[model samples]
Target chain A: MDKNLEKKVINYGEAIYEATYQEMQRDNNVFAYGLGADDPKGHYGTTKDLHLKFGKNRCFDTPLSEDGMTGVGIGAAMAGLRPIFIHQRMDFLLLCMNQIVNMASKMRYISSGEHCVPLVIRVAIGRSWGQGAQHSQALQSFFMHIPGLKVIAPTTPHDAKGGLIASIRDNNPVIYIEHRMLYKNAGYVPTNSFEIEIGKGRVLKDGNDITIVGVSHTVEDSLRASELLKSVGVNAEVIDPISLSPIDYEIIRNSVMKTKKLLVVDNGWTRCGFSSEIITDVAINCEKITCERLGFADCPCPTTPSLEKHFYPNPSSIAKLANRMCGGNIDWSPPEVVQHEILSFKGPF
Target chain B: MKNQFDIKKAYYLFLLIRKSEEKIIELYNSDKIKSPVHLSIGQEAIAVGVSLALSKSDIIFSNYRGHAHFIAREANLDKMWAELYGKSRGTARGKGGSMHLNDISKNFMPTSAIVTSAIPEAVGYAFALKYKKKNSVVICYHGEGATDEGVFWESLNFASLHDLPIIFICENNRYAIYSHQNTRSINDPIVSRAISFGIDAERISGNSTEEFFKATIRCKEKIKNNSKPQLLECMTSRWQDHVGVTQPELSKEEENNIKKAIKHDDLKNLENKLSKDEVLHIKKRVNKEIEHAIKFAEASDFPRSSELLENVYY
Candidate 1:
């Protein structure tokens, strides 16, 4: 926001790539690696050309050994090195749950502060296409439930760059979630390296009628919904909680206090999901508040576009929910506008 | 190839580990030490030999049954005793008990309770050492049961592919808790499995401290000189239960096997090499150290209740 600061317009993936490049250049102990870290596609371009720039020692591909490789990163971290272990899809993280949950997360506690696992596990959440069940999952809630891990899901290019740099420097294990749909969305990011404080939320757009909190890609939907709400004179406040684990409830509590109404939109399921957590926090801290939650329907994700659209909550649905919470006509529906990112998505990566 | 001074030191260490675990078995029933202990009674030689062969700068990642490895590294006896007693002054501040002992200054990394959990971590450390271009090798110690996990094979492949400077020592005591290795795995030797991964590997008797020491020396040299990983499947025996101090009931054949193992004890063999006066001196010194450690652990206080969440983060 500084007038004198230099900035460039880059997409979410490029922002992540820039952060990794800058961090590796700044710290010799920092390195990036994964299954496709050195592949031509470069893990959806976030890790593109990193191997060439940092050389094979610092940036390279790993075998299809998630559990082993994850523990390897954890070990490297304890031995005075920072490793960024990338996963092509969040769904595959299940393979290495033992390393992440039992080892990396507990290293500091079990060692009694003698060791710290400063490892970054970068995973992308999938959506659209026929990616289906195993290929697509938004499991931030699972990581967030664990005590020792710090989970972050950055929506914009700015936060993606800043959040990643912060995660790399953090002494605890950090799960960095990037929604695949947000990759092509461009935003103004600072040319210089920066760190967004972990466990902080940003007010993407300010209003007063109803508080709308979003997670990951749903933040974009919330922003668009806010615009639709404005036409109907229902001013909705939009919040993006970048860090999922140590969530900044104070920000949401403040917004909800003024608005006296809350609607949480999550990118995953509603049952035992992140939305439930946000709603519970606000409900506990505030009085006389009305709240509702939206996410994927409680079922396996269908592959067809028609069924998929119904499964996911979009801008129009979010706007209607906010409109109803603000005492507007519940039957009213806004014009359906397909997001540019969704329309431009070519195929399954 | 063994000098008199090195042989004496190795004997001293081997005897010390034996006496320390015997002391644990003695004090276990008193209920002072809180954690469940996995006794490394019969497998002392592997840890003793491997520890003696490695340089001071080399590192070790061990498993739950790590008392021998911890003792062989010459870590602070007082702190280790305090940790087993759940005292504040212990290593890991009493958070990690018998299974999770670690002395980073001694380069004995924290051991894990879950089997096969620390293999890839050791590989990762080796990768870091190689990346930093440090001339140090890591020794990863685990039971043969660890090979049952898929991550074990995965770690072996990764280490071989990267040519990491590491040595994997499988203490094949043959029992995973109550189940025998024959029931869990086929008769295929673990050394051949390692060789299949392109790592130079060999099998040696765990009861012979000198043989294990020589094998480990060769493995360490191969790792440091060629920057490749090696594996040693040390065939050994366990004298106690998988956990706790209770010895399991054995059949007639099992009893005879145990008697034979005790008869061929490496500690006794090492003692035979030393003079009576030298053995007496070593036993007296080790007994005094153990007594002092026990008193220190008894006197140390438990961690303050407020300190429970101190190290959950950085």
Candidate 2:
């Protein structure tokens, strides 16, 4: 194994920081601001040494007013500065909802092409260490719902640097979601500046049996699940759609055609989630596929270590689902889901 | 071109807003303007005074009562009327109605019904201008009610701290909807509140367009010379209701005092100052302008429903 691949096993937060730091160095317009970016005690140490290198003006701390600071970033973006705005947690991004959705996302449309807002907002998604409800929400799906936004969720360190580079160069606003769990997980990232094109999905493995599609940290989980299935004599293909919006459905559809079976692993809510979108797309495109399954439960992630084990899907869950779709549980009858109709109408007669 | 006043041009601007507001009220009631309108009939001086003092590069964030904004900025009266009529030629492509009328070419960003929402954004704009070392200013126009929003204070602190070029124009029109200014805050003089923050502030008669010019001139000079933010609280009054049709029932004494305070019928006063023939000629010219605007709006086409998604992702 190469020495570069050796560093790929580090934390995901470090990977995001490396990507941000590299992008800032590559582009003069790229800047980062949040709490602890300036202080030696960086929030996740992703911004460590940034203030020392770039000066406080370029990489500085904000006054805990997320709403005000976010608006400042939006304003700076409008003024021809491409700012990589960092929020410590994804949940805290809620504090600047108006700025993110109303101001940053809609400023270009509001200006009727008179102004272009190029902003990359980096947020840490986590269910980390009992921070519980306030700090555990993953909101990439919420940003994807907005029309003028591009969402990037990169699992590998290489893709992290590449996505950050692409986002900084894009004219429109991009929401870069960095999972806290993948910070130290390094990979073979290039030493120089380059862009990994956005809106393209990567096929990690090739097979003719079943397809497993996942995003962000869940991509790694899906790969592990595919390996477990392989040990049990099932060849499962895996794909990582780095860009959530403008998703490459053709790749998924092509893979599903060969496999005739699909499984989507999402780390977000089961209802109206990214997983739901993938499943619905596959159902429509590949109607005769042997089986389809979504691997997210309908509930908020739990805080306790043991309960969180049940909360998030593991390789075993993915493997079990893949096996079920392969008709491994032939003797067991599937539960019958009864359909119900309830209608209440109020009309002027 | 320098720091000088054009009194005649300034008077013309004031006349423009006053006449525009009068026309808006007539159209609003007559069903020509489908949307509810907020007329700044009595507060013409604030918009005219501030706009005249500003350069074309200087931006403005107007509130709901923005007819004065359109007229003061000398925006096309036809486009202004077309906007109110929901025609495709409107300032916001007819997507934004009365409250959201935005003309970016004139440097007036879209107005929001949410009070003080644009306050922090204005500060952000000023911050960018300052950071880029550009001689630009953002005139954030809000009402006394906006003071209640926490962003108002947040923006004030950020603007003053950074010494950004922002002119916080608080048009104190006595009432923010149903709530009176006194009911909201204990300070009778909000300008003094600005002084506490080390911001140069003044409390002036917002009704008098001339006073607004003087105040805004002083503010622009300060913003340019020192890059510090300033506050000008115009003690203005609205001639109509908060929104749509106004039924502001003033007593006989109140009406008499208000009439004397703002001198609503300035034509009558000008008639006393000039000849009756001159006043009639001015009225005749204004009527012609209004008629031209009406014809333009009538001829303009309404926006197609397909255009709803055209600019959402520009």
Candidate 3:
């Protein structure tokens, strides 16, 4: 990597902040609000300088009432304005499920396209620092289940900037889930306003072996695991599904056809998640392909680090799982596998 | 703007709503409509009174029992009935049945089935109206049962904190589903709760559409000067069940109270404001209109399978 060239790149959080800043400047109708939005930490730096840049009227903090505040956002959207409502943790989104699941998603259909609710709900998924069950829940799968709502979990800095701008511009309610750990991971991102199309997926690395599909943080791990598996006599293709609802299954199916194997990973529970969606698509399109799913255990997220280690999927653990499917030797240690934090987040939120 | 207060005209609107709801109850067993219907039969005056105060440019968000508001806002009766009939000609294109009826062109929002959900939504619309420097005001109407929901308090606090141009209209019919509010709610009345949030609030008789209309007009004036949220608690009664087209199972005393209330209902009182000839003329006109609306709904075609995904997104 060229050191001087690398200086132009930004991380996931910076991309998100820049996307919001640019979109607000582009359209006066776009405003953002939520709890901790105006706090000094600024929603883990994803919303840094937004309040100062846009003024208090545009970027502001809200009360702790999730259900009420979410409904407020919905109301604002209905009134010929675009709103970006943020939830610091995806876990707290459970408190406002009625508003999110029922009202926001059904606004357009119920109004016969008379009301176009252009709104975006940004929630931080995945975690670090023992946030426990209350602070750690990946709700992308849940949002994907909803019909009218669009769900996107952008993993890289470029996708963060492009995907968010797309969601802000999209004329429907979009649930934007960002994995907390991917915020610190740096990647190439343009400074100008751009959009990655909704219901589109990007292939990170192409290989002849089994395809590894991932969402949010799992995509980063899949990318790292693919590189490790290549070192061993196994080559794995890695795909990052940016959109969960209105998913682009064609990308995964195309990859699986060439690879003849699949491994699906998600930040949410393995039982009936986006992984299942991928597996079902493969089962329909492709024939006789071996596949496996990897995700968190089906229970509340544990607090202790030792238990937390078992809770999350790292590159090493994913590579180990991949090797079993592709008939490769298990390498307990790989210098390429990241041993440090992928999220680059330090928090007390 | 002191417009002519037409007693016969007001009764005509109320009769249209009453008969429309009655038609829904009669046709509900016919199995033409799939979704549940929440009728606001005797409580039409509250919505008619308050909504008549609003301009077509203004917006309204309402709860489950929204037929009265739908009619009060002057949404096409044929479309509303067609929506219940699951026809593409419906206001919401048959996507929303009784509870979710909306006319976007009329600036009436699709009603939320969840209680207290639309309260914050109205506040948000108020926030947008103020932000855009528009003169429009947003009003939210919900049943008394919604007052117990935490979102109701939160929305009031949010509205007052920002001084948004909104009004919250609560119809205290005293029952949430089957439970009477007197048995289930807090000792502090809802008006006091609104005042606690720094919102100006008042409690008045919902049986009088003229009184309710006057109060809402005054509230709109206050909101016009300084954008802020206000609350109005209307003492009303629902003659029907919480949902569906059947009569509610009430105690003998409760049933008697309803019967007595209906004897002096807004329509009966409102009739006294007009002559016997004028009242008969209005009733005849309203009945003809209701019959036309029924014929229109019955003739409208159900949605084709191709429309299953229409308007799911913009």
Candidate 4:
């Protein structure tokens, strides 16, 4: 890191807005559009003032036609325009699966490299406050199972800005998943434009007793868990696998090799989910490694706060699991840490 | 409304598509061409007329039955034949086969196998053209069955709302695979659906190449002048089964309708305007081209096994 480089504390949503604003200013062919792109909220402030800065043609609102609008984005990308398509919720991505999985993902191969879909699909994952089953989902695993798409979920503001810029410049289509809970969480982001490599992982905290890998918002929870683990004398290593598809397996493999124990905390379901994939890959590559996975229980997301609290894995639950994997006492429960994002969120948007 | 030279050129294109598809039927049993083919034997005039009306720079997006549209654009016949034969030198390097054919140099965008999939893409392409202030327009081709898909109406709404420069051509052949339009849709005309979406639309009855050509010219002018999309519901007949070379079995009334359609062939109508020597010259020229394309495809090699994983990503 350069000491002289300028940096500012910005939230994840603002960072994304900055990336879109900068990229649209940098390239004439790049445009952003979705259902509420020009609305006052601007897709939870990720697309704020973009329509004013870039005009309606470049940054506009589209009809409530997910499949058709997705195809439109693919077509525009094939026609030498970079399209940033914003979906307010990741759950709605199911409606455009045909366009995403069949059309955009296969365009390059079906065209034999003659056409490339340089498209960015920005979808936010909602949690808390009765979002229910349809509105809340972290479906990165669905995209990771696909062959042609590049899927990334950045936890911090710095990674969000850099990853979005990289996604916009990537020739192939990219599925960018943002956790709405991480939007208001601020971090030190560089003032200048930058791009973090898509298929790379970052170690938030280095330790030797156990390796705890997290996806999307779970990365933040895992970090808080590391603090609790340290108090118990079980120094844990926390890893953030930023890119789900084309995952940085080598990073997780190395961490598991050194620690000899792995615990994957996913923001989605464990069955046929990203955690299962990580555990399977690690088991195949590493020897004498103990692996456990944690995620939402195999059921629809409940709306009540009490059921939702038990439904999602938090810092205390993560630390308890990590301690159990390390052969430490699992009976001890740490004080619950209330997340500010959850308290601040007043959704049903 | 076109000149004599243009009309003759359109005739040549119409005959070329017809003969090329007929050649496909002739060679399909040989087992050399590995992909399933959807022939447009009786629907060539829609493609030819629209292709003739558009400028060289204009783009086209077509459905699975795209042989006519691909041929009407005067794209490389060698590549098209090679693609059908699954040759390495094909337009898509033998990856897409028949359902997905594209010639970027000719501005004919890749065709889609799924119904209503390419409709929104054409609108998107037209949107890009409008945003960039490009004078080029886009023509999207699909069957009447595509209108049954919800995405079709969604695309129409978006195109009309955005005022994109595009023309949606629905070749209503009265059948989707084995199901007739009567079984599939109600008594409402497909053009009325487009009109309901606030697009200027009309139905072009019969497979008249000149009428389709004139209508496309008028639509092109209107789209460019108003920067809005239009629709043309072209009523035609499918001469064969939806897939493969076999002729479909039809009822006596359907058979009589086919007989009437053959009697009023657009090719024959244009042939009457030309001298016998000119018709012979055009036939010889097209026949020679088709033979060369076949030879090129047969002589081309299959894609290497190592190339199976290639082009899966950028």
Candidate 5:
């Protein structure tokens, strides 16, 4: 019965598009605007036909001024409109740190709760095609550290739709980080106006030997690693955390109790990052659990395919790390490096 | 603009800001208030005059040196003073100090210290009002220094593009922390850039309350009749230095020029329109008000440590 309720197959980007469509259809006050919002690609098809569906006034494109437009969205959100402000690249958000941190985050607090900013800010992360270091940054850890910000990153098509709905309906500011690579991945999703509760995580593949947890696209890669681990006589559990801030530690704790082992994979850097926080959690919560961390190298991501091959971690690397922790007896040989199209994402970062 | 313009109230506002800023400087040597304050000692007329043209329902966004703007908005002097003192009962509950002074009930938002930040926020606020079909407009105040930021140009374009009900008031005091106007700005007039965005722009002497009031009234009319962004540059001067109570450091010629202008006095313009008895009465009343505010601020307690995390989230 539960399977039938969510029967339709949808890609990650379509799910986001559907969620935006449904949310706009549901609330007249909710509008989506940002750079390339009305472009032909519609921000990697996540915002396609939105301007045509709802008039240009409701869905629109913006100038190159990131900071000013961000403040404009904040002001609009404070005045009873739910604005979904999108940036093609998360790196552009650096220009408007004051708007997001000082203005949008503190508007309600300083107003003593008299004003509420129902804002949904969507940022796309890219990691390939020699986009260079400027375009290949995942600053989720930095944003999550700031107070009054709720960060949500969906790894599945189903969660993408629900998480966005929850973010738009939320009364505070939300930083919705979407991985571009996940936009092409498909899964079963519901067509209704449903919402997944924010600040929650779900176990994808359960096993008794090891618990492997990741966020966004890393979660999908971990699932692939779990399958590979099964062939190697290792039982690897997988988990996808839907939210970063207000992290649902209880789920990870329960998994740790069952497996007695934990490993965290972050989409960003490990230095002073979420992976570090997870390691600390295991040290404090489950003292006996063996642990490891995975993330970007603590340096700028290079552009060439040959250089990028060693730069980012893949499913093979993840499986190899898991094999080491679960008794290094498994035949975990590195696969033949498939010379990917120089343009295939190192991860759209 | 008929005889509705109150000479007494305008002079009273000017005196209120002059006395309050002087008091802040006088007390800065003491350790009682540690927050940085940008004094508008010589630019009181622009705020006082423009405020008379705005309705109580209109919202405002101000820059770092907005003490005079809030004073003209008739913000509670006690709470404002207490805010600078970091008292728990002050505006913004002491979370935002002098830089972010605001009274939402009066539609005066807490100003941001970031240069050019308030410009886009004002445009957004005006956009919201327009979206709701409300007649209320947003007035944004910024310094000449803010014009250098890109968001200022973006906001001007956005406001004009959407025909947002907003009047951007530029407080062109010429010196952005010792960088004179000619040294910092391009040769063309500042108002021309705003006009190029397809919005009406004007330049007025910041010392002339009469001209500033008339300009603001005309802008308000244009905004109400047909939604259009407007810009007004009021060329004023600051008697004191930026961000403190100390004398401004400048080249010898610049300092002499500033001193000569300060010697002309802020009350001289207002005094031309009021009787000697009226000037005396306004000064006496404003001083008493300033004195009471200072006493109240001094008596108030600092924000309790337990409330540190209170406003971090709504």
Candidate 6:
């Protein structure tokens, strides 16, 4: 359970695999399935030794049917198998809406807790790979909006491993999101297997200038911004709310109280994004935040590297905002806010 | 163990489907059971035959037109009617209407709506069986229209390549919605396509109970004992329109022709083997069972709204 004992700088993808493998070793009911896992190269080599070690029954390949496989996971979970389903790309999850939303999410409520479908669905969000609009979207919030689903996006190796282990052992269906870029990003993880409780958020770094909330790949940008802000004498505290659903609002609120200003760095699109919910919550519950700047990929993420850099929020953009907000010239009014009122019907005044 | 199947029980099951749907039709027009119904009136033999071949452990995935299939699987008629009436006590806690009926405890999964949807699920169930090295088989029931989905071909390929024990039952009710077999496909012979999958297949009269059972017996033998995956195309007819409550678009003469095929004598052909009293007793018993089911359903209360969110997760 100690995080310092394990090797540092391990790929988040490999860490997730190790975590899942350890869980599988602990329980015979734990199994994994998806495309490329059975292949020799194994899609980023996340599931390299799984098939050889666990045999084909535990580590199996599936035909290209996400809906069917998702349902199979649901049924298997009902039959006492802790199954983990993998969708190579996030967009492919659209095909399995009925399975995820209708069957998996609602099974517990529909069955009156007679049975729990404890299935884990892992998907990758690739932005810089030039996957274009269809393949590059970071749409984890879509599933997060679902009430019954427990959603998690672990940015570092430690959280990736710990979150996966927790999800496999949890008594509810979990949607595990991993970023394509963070797959190779390494961090220190515990040697012995352990579980990270789902729905609890972690504060990566503590400071007092401004609270920078980020998730998945954006966590790296937030940490980078924290470094840049520190160089400029503006201390920025970074919070990585790893689990998206059942989010630890307490940690977020506590961070906001110290900072007094909030910046949401998201990898998803801007409009109706996860950032919107954070901003709305801050507006309602906590002190009025200065420059609630939501840094997201500018447009539909382009496949070309040159265009994608502009799409995703870089350290420069986050640091610039952090410096500006800390400097006290903060304009919190969004563009949609009207500058002047045009009266079509003026009766009272 | 030689004749693991009981023919008398099979015949009784067939009579159950027939009597149940007939009563359902009577109740539908009389406004007692008020919901859109797809009565498997004439298609009882197919469900009965398919279910007879199935062990209690074997899984069956049925269609939206699945009253007979549910009854054939021995699902409680009271809960089924409760579901139709939108009572919380229904099979799906009143959430699933007629189309998305499922009783997992009984090993019957029916997606009462969504055409061609459950086929791939059945295939996946079969794949899971193979993955676990279980000697169980999955029986999938769909109309000829389901063949149009890409999942059908994909499932067929997966089943054949893996040698999974799955019986793909094409309950060819002659029509899908309003379109006849000719309108839906170029050829009416659905079984011919199954041969291309390099699997044993057949086409039998779905209306004939004895013939349907014989075909299913042969297919079940191939699926279970021989470890061979197969498909059985039952050329049956829907006694009612595409939906049961609505009047069929067929002309009076055309409707009568379909009804003629559903006469009591159509089943009485096998009655010579039994004495007059025995045949009469079977009919009387079936009619009594139908009356009891209706009474039970009528007495059942609607499902409480609290149960609506009970089965959404897990």
* Winning model by DockQ: 1
TM-score of 2: 0.87
Pairs in steric clash, model 1? none
How would the docking of model 2 be graded?
acceptable
What is the docking quality class of candidate 5?
medium
Query: If both were scored by DockQ, which would come out higher, candidate 1 or candidate 3?
Result: 1
The DockQ value obtained for model 4 is 0.82
Taking the candidates one at a time, how many backbone clashes does each contain?
0, 11, 1, 0, 7, 25
Please write out the lDDT profile of model 2 over residues B79-178, one tens digit for every residue. 7777788788877667666777777678777776567777777887787787678887888888888887666776787778778898999998778876
lDDT of 2 at A98: 80
lDDT of 6 by residue, A1-349 (tens): 4455656567787898888789889998888888766788665677777889998878878878676677667766765678898877898898888778766776555434545778999998765545778776778778878878989998888889989999999889999998877776777777778778887888899899899999887888778777766666888889999988878888888889878988988778767777887877888888767646555556666766577657767776777777788883344221221111111212111
Q: After superposition, which runs of candidate 1 have C-alpha atoms over 4 Å from their true positions?
A: A1-4, B1-5
* Residue B291 error, candidate 5, Å: 3.3
Q: Candidate order by DockQ, highest to lowest?
A: 1, 3, 4, 5, 2, 6
Docking class of 3: high
In TM-score terms, candidate 1 sits at: 0.98
Model 3 stretches with alpha carbons more than 4 Å out: A1-7, A330-336, A342-346, B1-4, B32-35
What is the C-alpha lDDT profile of model 2 across A1-349, one tens digit per residue? Answer: 6544343344455656666778777777778887667778576687888888876667887677777777777767766788878876899988888877877777665544556678888887765466466666777778888878888898887788778888888888898888766765656666556688889999988877889988787788787777777666789899999999768898999999988888888767767778778878888888787645554456666666567667667777777788788767634333222111001111110
For candidate 3, write residues A1-349 as lDDT tens digits: 6543343499888899989988999999999899888889888787776889888989999889899888888888888789999988898899889988888988888877778678899998757677888888887788888889999999889999999999999989999988777777798886567899999999989898889998888888888888788777788899988999889999998999898889998888988788888898889889989989999887889977789878877787888888878876554565546546633445664
Runs of candidate 4 exceeding 4 Å displacement: A1-4, B1-5
- Candidate 4 residue-wise lDDT, B218-263, digit = tens: 8988886885689999999999999999989999999999999999
RMSD of each: 1.6, 7.8, 2.6, 1.6, 2.8, 8.0
Which pairs clash in the backbone of model 4? none
The total of clashing pairs for model 3 equals 1
- Tens-place lDDT per residue, model 1, A1-349, is 8754889999999999999999999999999999989999998888888888889888898899999999999999989999999997999999999999999999888789899999999999888887677767889888988989999999999999999999999999999999989999899999999999999999999998999999999999999999998899999999999999899999999999999999999999999989899899888899999999999888888878889888889999999999998999989998786788877776765
Worst window of 10 by summed lDDT in candidate 3 chain B: B1-10
Model 1 docking grade:
high
